[model samples]
Each structure stands twice: as structure tokens, then as C-alpha cells.
Target: MSKFDKALTAIEETVNGALLLSATLLLFINVILRYVFTSSTTWAEEAIRYAIVWVTFFGASLCARNKMHVGIDIFIQMAPPLIKKCLLAFAQLTAAFFTAFITYFGWVSTELVIETAQKSPAMLMPMWIVYISMPLGSALMTIRFVAAAVAILRDKTTGAEVKNEDAVDISRL
Candidate 1:
């Protein structure tokens, strides 16, 4: 993989790993406290919720990186080669546009939350911290999608197939 690819992969893995670790630790602590002390802290719930949001956002980017997102390919399989390429290009463009939209709005929403000084009810954590994940994740996903689209276009122009490591195996599916 190129350096850029490695850097992106590393960032994704780090985010995913941190979120997973946080979720696991918080849940474990919550369980232990509830079972052993017969009391639970509300902060644990908030922590877990935020961790879940982070996981989801980063996970979506991971999905884009892997090309594992849901799509209908039945018609593409039957279409002429040139038509299929056009259709795929269109699909990628649509994805890029939507992701960009989300990123823009997410950043705005996060800033609004920050400016409003919103806090989580249970943990008293700043709402912007959680909301910030929205834009951050969408940005990551956008980057990944852009890279994939570029690769696809390059492959098409060069008469080479775009190979996705995580492409679904129909027989297994």
C-alpha cells in the first residue's frame, strides 16, 4: 500500500480500537459496579453512548474503505461494459456528494452545539464533544470515497479492473 493508504488505514484502526476499548471498559465497569455494589453510575451510560457513536462513525468509514456498504449490483452485472462503467461512476459521484453534504452539515451542527454549551444530562459532558464525531467521521468517509472513486476512474481509463479486497463473494452471500 502507498503511504497515504497506510496513513488512512492507521488512523481508522486507531479510532476503531480506541472506541472499542472504551466501550468494553465502560461496560465492564458498569456491570461490575451494578453486580457488586448494587448501584450504577449514570455517567457510565453516557460514556457508553458516546463511545457507540464514535464506533458507528468510524465504522462507516471503515465500511467505505472496504467497499462493504450495501448496493444493488444485479443490473450492473448484466449491463454493457461502457454502460456499467458510467453507472458505477455515477454511483460513486452520488456517494461523494452525499458524504460531502453530511460533512458540511455535521460540522455546522457540532459548532452550534458547542456554541450553545449543551451538556449531556447524565455525564455533564459537553455535547459538542459527542457531536464532533459526526463531522469527523463523515470527513473520513468522504476522503475514503474520493480515493475509491479516483482509483475506479483510473482503473477504467487504463482498462484495468478495480479490485476491492472486501468485495462480497456472491456464493457466500
Candidate 2:
């Protein structure tokens, strides 16, 4: 991985690490308060919900960066060398295109939310803040996928097929 990729990954890790830690702590405290005191912070649930939404979008980008998204790689793994290279190239390019398409629509939705000045009932936070994640996450994912595709093409041109160690194999767990 390049230094630039390392920097971006570190930033994503910091943001998501803080988000998950805070959300977990908030929920734990909220549960304790509701049960022990027979009362709840009115904004706790809303805060947790928003935190989860933020985490999910950001986490997805992290997953994209790591190439951890679920993939049925059985076929690719079994294919002949040249065919496998072609398949991998096709898949990476396809993912980039798909994410860019989603980002475009997500931006449209974000604009609508911003223009309408929608507010959440609990905290009256501008809904655009939450809506912005959709485009932001998809855009981040698009960039990652494009990078992956370019890397694959470059490697293929140079006759290299580097395995991604970061790709999660969930069956092991």
C-alpha cells in the first residue's frame, strides 16, 4: 500500500473507532439509566440511532478500502489464470461504476434533504447532516474501487497478481 492509502486508512480507522466506541458507551449507559432509574435521556435513543447510521456508512467505506465486502470468489479462485485476471479486473471496474452510480443518486437525495430543511423530531438536527453520509460513503467507496481497479490493471500489465491480505474470510470465524 502507498503512503497516501495508509493515511486515508488511518483517518478512517480513527473516525470509525471513535464512533463505535462512543455509540457503544452511550447505549450501555442509556440501558443502565432506563432500568435503574426508571427514566431515560430523551435524546439518547436518537443519538444512538444517528451514531449507528454514521458508523454504518463510514464502516462501509472502510470495508471497501479493505476489500472486505462479501464476494463469492469460488469461481474466481477456480478459474484459469488468464480468466481469473479478467474476472478480477471486470469485478473491480464494475464495483467502481456501481458505487459512482449510487453516489450520484445519493447526492440528489442529499440535496433534497438540505433544500427541504428537514429536521429530526428528537434533536431537531438538520436531516441533511445524516443524509450527507449516503453520498459521502458512496463517493469514498467509488474512489477506493477505482484505485483497486487501476492497481489491478497496473499489476496485470506488469504480470503481477498481489493478493489482498485485508480481505476478510468470514468462514474462518
Clash count of each predicted structure: 0, 0
Model 1 poorest 10 in a row by lDDT = 156-165
Backbone-clash count (model 2): 0
TM-score of each candidate structure, all chains considered together: 0.88, 0.87
**Candidate number with greatest TM-score:** 1
Worst 10 residues of 2 by lDDT: 156-165
Estimate the overall C-alpha local distance difference test score of candidate 2.
Answer: 0.80
Best by lDDT: 1
Note the residue pairs that clash in candidate 1.
none
Tens digits of lDDT, candidate 2, 6-121: 88778777877887899899999999999999888888789888888878877888888778887777666656666667777788779889889989999999999999999999
